[model samples]
Target chain A: MIGRLNHVAIAVPDLEAASAQYRDALGATVGGPQDEPDHGVTVVFIELPNTKIELLYPLGEASPIQGFLDKNPSGGIHHVCYEVEDILVARDHLIETGARVLGGGEPKIGAHGKPVLFLHPKDFNGCLIELEQV
Target chain B: MIGRLNHVAIAVPDLEAASAQYRDALGATVGGPQDEPDHGVTVVFIELPNTKIELLYPLGEASPIQGFLDKNPSGGIHHVCYEVEDILVARDHLIETGARVLGGGEPKIGAHGKPVLFLHPKDFNGCLIELEQV
Candidate 1:
């Protein structure tokens, strides 16, 4: 079973500005500002009591975040993450259900080095879902 | 400050069917299948470790869930809720920032008797946000 909610990812045009607004308005502390060269995006995390909020911004012209921003325009939720006991099990279950795995392999270290993997949004009716094991 | 994530609401075509899908797929036990006569929605709750998942289906032709489902053909997330220490404070803060309050006043006892209020989607970039205090 999925253990708990890990975080909710939000796609933003500018991570810094979004982070500042979230901090000032919600009083959430910023955790990290890290880059994912593989995905061509930069992400920052804000920790909350039961879950974290991740702000994502495209790092390059070819980044998926840019496409999402262009499509949504208003910068809303990008994905919802569920913490799992085993990433491989979750990935396999999703794969068995014909869901496309974004990373195409076992989970790798994510923002805080926790094992994480993302499933394609198409399979979930336009909602991106991520599985993480800490 | 937002204390935690209270729930994630999904607009579905059928509450019972969606509840079954979520229960069988994620092994989450169903909590409630209550009706909101005010909003014209029949909602089901599935409790998780730190948050709840709410499946909402329209009760009448004028229900907002119908409009949401009609707009987004493919079923997707409807709203993400944050638990607040004080619903009035949170509502006031959001209203001061020019966000329209859907309920137009202090929160009332929502499902399970918690104070809850929803913000107008137009203000939040098409995302329906709910503030709940439990």
Candidate 2:
């Protein structure tokens, strides 16, 4: 079963501005920025009492956020991360039901330091979903 | 303060089909369909262990889902709802800090029978946010 919502990610053109808005304007506790070179993006987490909001920005020319921001100039929600009891079990179940796991069908170390897998958006009716093992 | 992640709303072209996908395929407990005329959408709640997923379909000629579905024909995540400890406090803080509340800044009765308010998509970096009093 899906445990809980881990975080919701938004692709932003300017990470500092987005982080500042959530911190200064919303009065939310904001974490410092961190670069995930493997993912080709830099991110800052806004700490909400319920769940975290991840602000993603391109870290390099090959960053995927570059493409997402190119299409949505004003930035937008990119994806959501939900916690799962066991990622391998969830992965097998999703595959058994014809859900395609992205990134070569293996889990990766996500921003939360948990094993995470991405499911194909087409399989989930056009919404990209991330499952993280808790 | 936000209490917990309440639910995530997804716009769907076919409510029954989407509900079935989550139920039979994802092994989730699905609830019966509900007509929310005030919101102009019919929704089905998929019960996950920690949170719920709301599948929404247009209910009338002027339903907002019609436009969202028109843009994303295959359907997609529409908005996310988070529980707030106090609705009025959260609203006042958000407004005072420059967040635009939707529907004239009044809390409406949402699907979960709670007082809910929607924040503007532009304010929080293009994510339509719902704050529910819990």
lDDT of 2 by residue, B19-131 (tens): 88788666678999999988899999877666778899999889977998999998888998878778989999889887899999989897778999999988777788899
Per-residue error (Å), model 1, residue B111: 3.6
In candidate 2, how many clashes are counted? Answer: 0
lDDT of 2 by residue, A19-109 (tens): 8887775567889999998889999987766677889999977997788788888788888787888899889988888879998998999
Ten contiguous residues minimizing lDDT sum, candidate 2 chain A:
A20-29
In candidate 1 chain A, what residue range of length 10 has the lowest lDDT sum? A119-128
True contacts kept of each: 0.53, 0.52
| Best-performing candidate as measured by TM-score | 2
Q: Which stretches of candidate 2 lie over 4 Å from their true place?
A: none
Could you tell me which residue pairs clash in candidate 2?
Answer: none
- If scored against the real structure, what TM-score would every candidate get? 0.85, 0.90
- Candidate 1 stretches with Cα past 4 Å from truth are A97-109, B103-109, B120-126
